[model samples]
Target: MVDSTLPLFDEMPPAGQVAAFKAAFDAWLAEQRGSGSLRQDGSVAVYEDMWEAFAAWCLSQSPVVTLSSLDLADLQAFQSARFGRKSSDLSLTPRYALRLMRLIDRVLRHHASRTEAVANPAAADWIAANPEIRYADAAHADPLPEYLSVSEARQLIAFLSSARPRPGKSRDAQAPLTWQEVRNRASVGLQLGAGLTPGDVRALTLDSPVSQGSRVRERPWKLQVPGNGNSPARETPVAPWAAELLQHWLVVRTEAGIAGTFLFPSTRTGKQWQKPSQYECAKRVLEEAGADSREGGSFRLRHTFALRQLRRGTSPQQVAGWLGIEPSKMKRYERVLPGVIEVV
Candidate 1:
């Protein structure tokens, strides 16, 4: 029944009606799935769980939850509770829970869309303000970011330079070194030179757009990287050396008869290989480079690049953009480097 005093078109189902509402919501969710709007990007189930957790919190309330009864303050309360920002049964850890709050907002939006109800004002506020960078346990001392020494970094780069370069503009960029060598050199180059995550290097396409400044300077090339990690698709700087290596690899890749959309497609599968294979390849490069197994791995390549940038006096904000990570996350790298502003 419609209530004239109520804000929504229909009342949020009472406790007895909660079961029915759940069934109906499930039906709506199925519809969303069928329509392909609720795309499975690995977080769909998590959203559902978050929604169910919100519902449980509502059910445990003093006056009980309903359309009119659940106001803006109530929504804020739920946001706090879910992230352990307030007292609740949700076990979400403080580290990732702040990020998880956005998913909870998404669920509420879906509910509001289906029910024609007043949207969660608190969630809107949280999304707008995006909350300050308040991590849990602020008192804890952070660990220093790991990095390779300049000598080791040089060794790492030199070790991966297996492709033989060809001279002359008329010739292809590289001579025979097998397709695997081409892929290995290019892969490591991007991680170390461009500060790209391993996944980003793998996901890069042969036809993926590249942007370069016309002024013609060193490291002028930047890749419009596809979305990697939690970051949106953003332009990432590619050092001149890495760019040179990439052009060379393209020639060898063609010679080896590898054809795929990916910049470094697997010769066996014609698609990007997973991290396990990437790790194996990285270990081989490290072995050849004489880099300690404990010190150098696939991810450490990115860390080395990031730390170098910090050492070069780039601001944390700038480095964060370069590496596709949160600015606050850069503090770990910053703690190790002394007086960034004074470096230049």
Candidate 2:
């Protein structure tokens, strides 16, 4: 059993380089833990086990794969040996493969940071340049995301369109719809029409719905979805029918005198709505529409929007742009395209 606490030598022979690398990585992990950067949790054990397994594999190689000679090819060979079809007992699922890849990349990056001589083989740019390094075993990939059928979507839209707030009494039944009801309709409409995530919907300002000086009630309303570190800002056109619902809400919003910049704010405080409140709103709306509220959250609404575009002869790349996701992520949506038989 190799002791991880073993101190690395300034110079080591090819045979002992792997052990030295492991020692350095272990020491780094310990330092991180001591600094409160890494938690003392099951995840630390996972990292240890994965690194030990990888180091052992390196020692077992015919030429003894060492730190100095380690490169993309070496990593690829190790991945194939451990996870490819030949290893029936240790065949890798996509999830495990992804985790393994992440572990290896982190370890390699740490090693590179300490030892300037050794280049990190798993550097993001290098791996991106060599796309084959990514686990692309489509056969074992997770199933396509769930989305609403056309009929279900239509039903949901109809329910939202005619939905009115319940009256307090028989005489008050003729009262107009509340602003909250209109806001809920607009929120759901943005998700179902523009493929906006709940975060995207929450991040919107009063001016988000307007596009190129277009008015609130205008046709072809383009929604400006704000972005964070992961995705860039994008503008997507809301479906005309959904835009109509949104228009009604915008009018109600102004008249209601809600004192917030956020397009959807708390009805009472006019502050940003909490995540649970948004989720509950979506759930209640789904339940009211007789849709599967259990599995059909805001994400399902976005997925439905994606699927709808794909089914309507829109290119996957175009749809991906609309959804503010990478084009590669759209591959899953392609599985459900018309005439495409989805293999279980």
Candidate 3:
């Protein structure tokens, strides 16, 4: 018993559909405001502005965009248009991008909950499918610091120590103990053994690794980490194991004709290596030593260094000085210490 004059919602005109969506959106916002779900602040204005931009973009698309028609691809395209397509060209950082995506997801989920006909395309499963979005979500999440266990550290050190130097003209770049391998070994060793940050590693000069005359080979090496705007200059002792690797690198670096003041320099120019290259070098070493390389980068190694020192009865203040960070920041590490429970 279909009425001949009944209105077809599915075949509604693009303009009408957009108007309907706007009306539904306004109603949702009002309900959220009334329920105190949305605070009376600048955040509400930001949400409104983002929605306006999204709606305008939807209207501009061919065949028109309806609330029900929105999908992951459409959301991704909107993100690409608002932010830049490439990571380098991105106007917003990962955290901000994550906030934007979350806003859209929330609004859509609210709309879907009220309308049985509509489905939320930005569900957790769908969002997890996009690596960029997933990474952004993770970047915004609160998590424990990534570090190595005592056993893992021992295994990594053993591997680095056993890796023999292959010094010859016909040596493969991929082989162990080549110029690059020795350099990477020393770089990672600084992070694990001396608690050097990636920036600290880059800032080191040829004379940075100071050793006492005559006892240079017998005693532990001292490193001079230069200060920047954030931290002050500090001298820290390097572990004997790591110092040995660094000494080996000095010889290889000279023989390989890497002429520069910088300790870890680009092979061709002997100038400071780019940040990405430095990170990759550390990551490669971690992978070779069978350590986790997915998160934390060199910072994990630094964390491992901090935890190791703390476990050995080193005071937080002293460790903080070595790390070039405030002592209060060490509280996080203290809370994670084995057999220690934070009251607060």
Candidate 3 residue lDDT tens string, 1-344: 99978667544347686786687668778888999998877878877776777788777776676677776566656766876456674435765666666666676777777776555654342343333455665643434566776677887887775543434534344354678887888888888889988778888888788877526663448798888555678988788788877877787788888887898996646778755567657767888889855456557778888888887788999999989989987887876787432210
lDDT of 1 by residue, 144-235 (tens): 54567667777777666545453453345545466786687778888888887767877778655364552443223777778865566777
Per-candidate total of colliding backbone pairs = 0, 0, 0
Taken over the whole model, the C-alpha lDDT of each candidate is 0.63, 0.69, 0.72
Which has the higher lDDT value, candidate number 1 or candidate number 3?
3
Model 2: worst 10 consecutive residues (lDDT sum):
123-132
The lDDT, on a scale of 0 to 1, for candidate 2 is 0.69
- lDDT top scorer: 3
User: Can you list the residue pairs that collide in candidate 3?
Assistant: none
Tens digits of per-residue lDDT for model 2, 240-275: 777777776776778788887888996645799755
Please identify which of the two predictions, 2 or 3, would achieve the higher TM-score against the true structure. Answer: 3
What's the lDDT for residue 214 in model 2? 59
Distance from true position, residue 137, model 3, in Å?
A: 7.6
* Model 2 residue 233 distance off true place after TM-score fit, in angstroms: 1.1
